[model samples]
Target chain A: MSDAAATLKSLPQSGGFNNSPLAQWVKANLFPNWWSTVITLVLTYFILKFLFGALSWSLFNAVWSIEGTDTEVCRELKGIGACWALIAEKHRFILFGTYPFQEHWRPALLIVVFLVLYGLSTVRALWNYWLGVVWAAGLLSIGILMWGGVFGLRFVEQERWGGLPITLMLATFGIALAFPLGILLALGRRSDMPAIKAICVAYIELIRGVPLISLLFMASVMLPLFLPEGLTIDKLLRAQIAIILFAAAYLAEVVRGGLQAIPKGQYEAADALGLSYWKKTGFIVLPQALKIVIPPLVNTFIGLFKDTSLVLIIGIYDLLNAAKTSTIEPKWQGFSIEAYVFVSIIYFVFCFAMSKYSQKIEAELSHTHKH
Target chain B: MASIPRSRPAPPSIKLSLSDPVVRAIVFQVLVVGGVALLVWYLVSNTMANMEARKIASGFGFLNREAGFAISEHSIDYSPADSYFRALVVGVLNTLIVAILGIILATILGTIIGIGRLAKNWLISQICSVYIEVMRNLPLALQLVFWYYAVILENLPSAREAHNPLPGVFVSSRGIMVPVPANDPTYGWMLIACLIGIVGTVLLSRWAKARQAATGQQFPMLRAAAGLILGLPLLAWLAGGAPTVLDWPELRGFNFQGGGTLTPEFAALLIGLVTYTAAFVAEIVRSGILAVSHGQTEASSALGLKRGLTLRLVILPQALRVIIPPMISQYLNITKNSSLAVLIGYPDLVSIANTTLNQTGQAIEGIGIIMMVYLTVSLSIAAFGNWYNKRIALTER
Candidate 1:
């Protein structure tokens, strides 16, 4: 009875911080020791200093707006404060590049369609054959929304496409096209057939060895030469193809990791059940492998999304290019700082959301495994 | 049971039908190879037709032609009058400069930040976490432009108003200008001595390690290595009369003329790549350290090992096994990413090749050159990584 009482008494002290008061928690975490206090004090000073400087520059002393494209107000406060008037003036161009000004509603609506598709895809219950059909429908509507010639809607050539919609298209289409190709490549690399394995290895390695810019340069400049006479691909399509091919190589490696992770017994079990290679892989192997690899696939997707910005190098105006163009105008020439900051926040938001989601999923996966 | 004679089933005979796996494998390989060959033939024929129609010559002969355009920066002496090959050499060297410096700096910074992320101080860890996330989530290209436009070009004043951030270092829109050692032959001897000292230190460590295994006695190996590395170089410098003259940059007409300078383009590219890559490196490092199980540290502590010895003998070796492969890939990433120098006009290989392709209209050859150079570098690094990994791999037996 004495021993039992002693064990019970020690439980609360061992689980110390679970229901502790705020002051105790704060003292333990933030100022647990002299060194920690020193760190907290130093970090607090710098953070406050930066916050004050940034607040004054971006909010307090900023030029919010100027009437009628006037530069005098912004020019006066060039270094002293932010010229958010530039962002307000150039947000349209930055959001939707050379697309017809009157038809901005289409791209704007296209952005909404993308968001809805993303939202649908994110829900766990929707991950089924219906999801693929939904994606197909979503992609078709995306095409129609981007290029309309029927139903009293004006047709807009892809040449005029730019900005955020283009960024999304490049990233989304890249992943959509690359995922299957990556799976096939991964399967081929693991196959017993030497020729197929060699081909897959060669493709993946050649694509991955060089930087994306080199491939973009090839797609933009050399791809024309490789095509038949009188046949030309549009710049955006060419860049999109390059992105698909590049992303597939990286995705293939990730999938290969998943493939390697499967125990030999699983493959043997499927084989003993009289399943053919394709049936076994598609019905059994892939389901388990892809499930295990989703978190890493999301990481690859984050990379792909960021890589879409490189399309600007080939003069296919993506978001970064739009921002650069916004600054080229005489009115907004010196306000690229504001332009970049604005665009960076957008990019950051997308990337951060994806990374957080990926982290959460990974944590859940590890949790299940632990249990 | 004895009267029943059981006949063994014959092993499955090979058949030419699709049901036979051997036959299927052969047929599949054939079809795939044939299809690939057909595609290659078609593309080649098309390329040939297009080249003839466009009247564009396809050969490496253009490499010998005069590169009429000027490169903004070059590691070696280069002129507009130089051959295209020489210009390419300059660009390759420039790319190497960024790769080498970026790798070194990123490794140092990433290790520090990674350790900081695990600090006992909650504020320090939080600060490190924020730094990694913010640096990583933003696109590298955007960061490069910001560094070029907002930080370097816009914020820095012109040459006349160059700010002295350090004792003899100047920052301006023109680029960074800092003091350089005056032309002295003694520095060359010192550099050679430093190289020799490095080699000597390696030999000393091998000997010390063998001695420790044999005698179980510790040697002051670090002090001995340090002395060899530093003392030899210092002795060489002292023997050469210890010249300490420096050529400080001065405002001459419109620019600083006397010192070693970093072009704005190079500075932007380097800073962007190093900081961006450091975030990735930090994550890899943290994960590697975390991969070392807590039980190993406890075991070492229970064995009466000091904290430093516990970490060195138990934790680090295991952590390194997880750390090295990813760390190598990060190095590879830095090398590949240095190609982004084109965006900021750093005159790297891609930029130089782009100019060449435009000037000579040798698209196929230009692209071929780029792929070859990158492939060679990449394969070499991969090969080296495999070798190093094998050397450090655990002996299971």
Candidate 2:
């Protein structure tokens, strides 16, 4: 027993917690030095002041209900808070734009469906051939709902379809269609034939050299001129095609980066096996190259999503346009801040989720590569 | 094995021309080229027919016609009487102004934020991360609109309630009016002095480098260069009467008069572009800095170098190699995105061309001009980037 006691005395002593966890954390992280302490204090004070001011403006003094012309209430509150009642009064118009009032449910449901499809896609277990089928079916259902000509539902022109549904459809279709075209273009760029290579290079560079706004303008203006008389296409379709072509060029470059990363040994091995060219590319090469490029591919998708908002310039009533239009209501003329904030939150949520998903996929891919 | 092979090797049969891979490839190429040519021909013919039917005379001739539109912000003197070509020039200049200013501001802000992300202070780093995430995730167009309508116009006090926040500055919904120097003839001499100072600084820096190599002595090259550039210009200005006349804006009627104005549209476009692009630049910078292995810092420290010295001598040179290429692309992106200025009525090239096209029914020509301008800008930036990249690339002998 005496020997044991002596051994215990020789062990390192723990500095038994003299301070609380919060105090210790604060000392270590924020107040390690005089300058750090000052900086921390000053920054914290300003951040809190700003936060509380925003909170009070957005919450405490904000008018919540659409009762009466609540413009008076907002004027009285002045700079103290937001006028949320403006959003309340204009939410439907902001969400659906010129879509028929009673049929607002169609777009509202389409948004939920799109969200479900997005969620489904995020699940690793659902990543199979069936996923493609699901996407196709989902897109078809969304189309039928938006352009109702069957089941006794009223027929709505594409022109009448606006707001969030249009934004979702354009982005989804743009990325989906661009993917295959991008792969083809990437392949063409890497081909041995000079003619094919030149054409691909020219297309990619020309599209990438200009802004999406210019392309949209070309679609809206020049496309009609190029088409024969009586072969008119919908304006929305024209913009959608422009988006597809523009995205394909960017995506082609990204895919080319992945293809270049692949080892020449893989191609040589497949050739040695006497695999046909298409078989080799489709079965042996593409799977690995595409897997390697998933992160960048998702990044391109995020860019495409943000870019879809530019359709507003071409007079498309996308989500941002709808929100902007809502603010023009005489009753809510100056309350654009609230509407913009709401729309920004929606964009932020989608973009942040996509970025996070890409990061996660990148981490997983690298982890798998380690084995 | 050779004897066995000699037993029965019938003269190699010539492959059928139809089955030959070379022939197949040629056919495929011909088919693709022919298809593309056919499509182009079809488009041209259809366009011609459409133009004939619409009675729209198509050509570049419209460029010489008068552009009867007033541009709000122009770097050059522009009037409704100006030809469309001159109007387009003003538009291009306006685009360049925004791009140049945006590049400068974004670089400054992004570098600061990027360094802050790696700061020893946890709160500072977190704040910087949040700022980057929030700024990057939102659509730039939305941000531009919000900045124009909500942040600047709605929030600022109207002209009737204008306030002088600074000695010679006025803030109102009309715009932020600030004092500017009157155009003086002696300014040209000051500019010449500045050019001379720049040349002198370059020569001095090269001399300093040579002296350091020859004699192992350190010179304060940066301080000396700054003195030459700034002091020479100051002395020249002083010699030329100091040109101290200020054009301070005064509240006249419902507007401010007599000073340069930063219109709300310009302010909004600049802020939106800078903040959005800065987020991307911050990530590039952070990644570039991180890419320089941590061992570099430790090695410099082991050699007894101070922190700032280590960063300057060991870290930045390596980080810049990684930073520059992406930074070039960001610059190109900024130039291209400046087209979005039209959303807020900033009369950029696209906006001006759009108006011209609407007036002249020259959609094809208008779009073609816009494309050519953008392509030229893009190609120039890319060419410059490639040259710079080659100069800085690692020389692996």
**Candidate that would win on lDDT:** 2
The TM-scores that each candidate's chain B achieves against the reference are 0.94, 0.92
**Which interface RMSD values do the candidates have, in the order shown?**
5.6, 4.5
For model 1, name the residue pairs that clash. Answer: none
lDDT of 1 by residue, A138-231 (tens): 8898899889998788999998999999999999999999999999999999987889999999999999899998999989997888898788
Best by DockQ: 2
Candidate 1: residue B312 lDDT (0-100): 88
The docking quality of candidate 1, as DockQ, is 0.51
In order, what DockQ does each candidate have? 0.51, 0.52
> Top model by TM-score, which number?
1
B1-397 per-residue lDDT for model 2 (tens digits): 1122235554497555744555566788899999999999999999999999999998899788889989888888889998999999999999989999999999999999999998877789889999999998999999999999987888889877887888988888787899998989778888898999999999988999999999999999879988989989899999998989988888888888898999988989999999999999999999999999999999999999999999998999899999999999999999999999989988889999999899999899999999999999999999999999989888899
Listing every candidate in turn, what is its Cα RMSD in Å to the true structure after a full C-alpha superposition? 5.0, 5.2
